[model samples]
Target: MSRDGTSASRNAPLVGTLLVLGYCVINSTKSVFEGSLVQHLSPEFIAFNSFVLAQGFYFMICRDKAALLATVRRCLPDVIALNVATMVSWVAVLYAFTVFEPAMANSVILGLVPSITIALGFKLRPGVRALRLEVVAALGMLAAMSFLVAAAWNGSSAIGDLPKDDLAAGLIYCVLTSFALSAITYFTRRLGDQGMSVQQMMASRFGVLILVTLGLLIGRDSFDAYTPRNIGAILLISIVGVIVSLYLLQAGMVRTEPITVSMLFGTNLIITYVVQFLDPRLHQSTTTFVGVLVLSAAMCLGAWARWRDGRDNPPAGVPDKVPAEVPAEAEGTTQNVGNRT
Candidate 1:
């Protein structure tokens, strides 16, 4: 383990870029699936797909049959929490879609993501402190929000403008979704401290979601018996969103700081909007534009914080566990969870 805060085996810059590209594709596909996939399958069935595909991929990567079950049992609780949060987030977003336009709802839902994550950070990891440059980063986030406000974004109008009751329902869904996703990020960071591979963490997380889905099927829905469309959506989600995109996230987070990773993911706001703009059928409005700018400012805040971290190390309160050199599989055996940084 190197004394530096990051893991010792710095994945090559080229490799990291490739990972980002991979995730971008996966995530973009996910954007499509989020709006479209639910029409074909039950949530329960989708969960099972995650389990099967993620598990299959994890095994293929590790190829260590002996340690797999033991590792899973060891981290079961954290994994389950992650899955719960994940399911909640998905449900919330889906509910939002039912009540709002995909573009508007997605913007607001994701626009609030970094702010929600900041709240989660304070709640979950009490010891960690925000860096001075984080203030600047925070300012950037605010700027981005301003852009969004100018855009005059409203989720309901595009979806036929729900009634007052439906609007209330939509708000609840968005909030729940945000809370769940925020917690998922916090828990994943904790799992990282455990030295688990991104693959392992994802496998365990998705694996539990599958179980939850199966449990839901006992009487909840007839999803245990999959139809062709259900099977296809689940398979696509597992393969693209969970297996491919998440590996990039895992590799990126291992190389990057947690907050930085959050910022990177937040960039999806830009990605989604740009995609919306290019789509002639997807009309943009005033409030939506305002929201984008405002959110852009917030993202800048996150970026500034990372830039500052590069100048000086992050506060030592958050212990650096995995040496940059040690592989995820080697966490328990080779690396002592000492502050290698």
Candidate 2:
């Protein structure tokens, strides 16, 4: 790659790492408080309210209409696709949680995100290639997630005990959720590369999300489920989970490789696993502890691959920074040469 390409590539991963950490931190904190709220309201109701508040906040923070319009004009298809992915993923995950255990459903579905993102990037992303090591790292992440789920699995509970209808429906929803998340990771990087800010991408994304949620609320008659307490909780979830998390994700997407984002995003559950250990009701078995260690190792491997790739493939057009003293030195030399002349 040329200098500019090399520089961009190098910078992208660093940006991605910071943003992923931001996403993880903010979302993990929000999640700690989310369980109680979920019990009081339907997923759709909570989702709708959260986006409505988030969208409103986005408008307040993003005041430059001209730039926003230009971004929309330039990346309409991508923006729309991204919003659809967001909407679909949220709805699918919420529905899946209704039919399956939260840990089991999330583990199975989210584990697919890294692989799907890699596959999609290979097929759809021009000029972007997946390295063998990257692929292996992604698979490792999936394996680690599976192990986490296994650790949480109750030996007494069997798949046969789940109603066949609910199981099939949950599986379908889970698949959709995984594919939608894959799309989000891919498109987020695409838009970020196109020079859109996290705020701009988030504002547009939430704008669409609000509309989608509204339609769902009206169509499903879920308004009756919302209470004053749930309303407050949903607002909180929106500000932290929807707004902050999505912004960090977009910011990170702009800087990092998509696969890195996918792999790291899958690890968000690590926070939940840690929180579980604090609760007497949520016991951590020897298997769960082992799974946590494996998950940590997988994340380390994926991060290393990303770092190596960035170093190896720098972006063109970015020149090395000139020494600040060079201009002054040249001016002094020019004066001396003039005196001699």
Candidate 3:
């Protein structure tokens, strides 16, 4: 009994680490393309592309359309909240880049997300406990993040480094962006709260994001900006940056500790950290290591918590132990869909 418990406990952090590392590689794979696309592509296009791809994947992978449609319909209201939040995060991040250095802006804005996720995770699961082992792991990763930050300082040249004013601006942007993401995570968790499956939640997030961003694009007069270069960027953004990135992320969310991986996701900041060495013209900072360390520690802690909490996660197709008040229609639809699948 003791050995089994020890093994499971050990597996918890391993799962969490792998989850973050996987996403790091996924997001990093296209980081080069991502920065340029963000500059050139319309927000609406990016949002639309990602959401469509996400939904396409969801619909294809879902075993049952009945349940999918039912959950989507039932969960639509909550998804709007998520879409708005994410839309804001996207816009702010782009704008932040204008005023702050990308690395600095990413460090603060992206770093805040993990902390927000951890906070929201607990808000969603009030009964979840904090574990000591996870805390140690968080510390270790934080030390690593510090190394990365230092590595960044020691590392890049092409990226922006936030000056005092830029740092201030970055913080302001990061805080708001963090708030927006809190909503994204919170509402998605609420979708889960409403008895929607992962498929339903991912589908709704994509569908709503696409619709909303498309509407915004039309209104913002961003249509005339399209050139062949922009068109290809949007397509690439959709296929690699948006769809593939989101698919990997959502899958990670489903399979592992979301808050933990979310925290570890702070590594996304200096997307060019390691590669910038080839150029040697990129800006590097020594403090980046310390910042990375702090961020990593927080994420590892969050992952540990998520792993510990996952044990209590309701099995597939079951309500949480507390019993969410799902609508009768929702229950029927889920059952119908499950049966069909």
**lDDT agreement with native, every candidate:** 0.54, 0.60, 0.52
What does candidate 1 score on TM? Answer: 0.71
Candidate 1 lDDT, 216-299, residue by residue in tens: 767675554566766777777777776667666556545554344444545554555555554344455555545655655555
TM-score of 3: 0.63
Candidate 2 structure quality by residue, lDDT tens digits, 195-246: 7766677678855656877887889777744567666677768766776676
Candidate closest to the true structure, highest TM-score: 2
Model 2, total clashes = 15
By lDDT, the candidates rank as: 2, 1, 3
| Deviating ranges (above 4 Å) for candidate 1 | 1-11, 39-41, 72-76, 132-160, 217-230, 251-264, 276-282, 314-341
Please list the residue runs of candidate 3 whose C-alpha ends up more than 4 Å from where it truly belongs after superposition. Answer: 1-20, 29-32, 40-45, 49-66, 114-170, 224-226, 249-272, 275-281, 305-341
Backbone atom clashes (below 3 Å) for every candidate: 44, 15, 23
Could you give the candidate ranking by TM-score, starting with the highest? 2, 1, 3
RMSD of each: 7.3, 12.7, 9.1
* Model 3 deviation from native, Cα RMSD in Å: 9.1
Worst 10 residues of 2 by lDDT: 332-341
RMSD of 1: 7.3
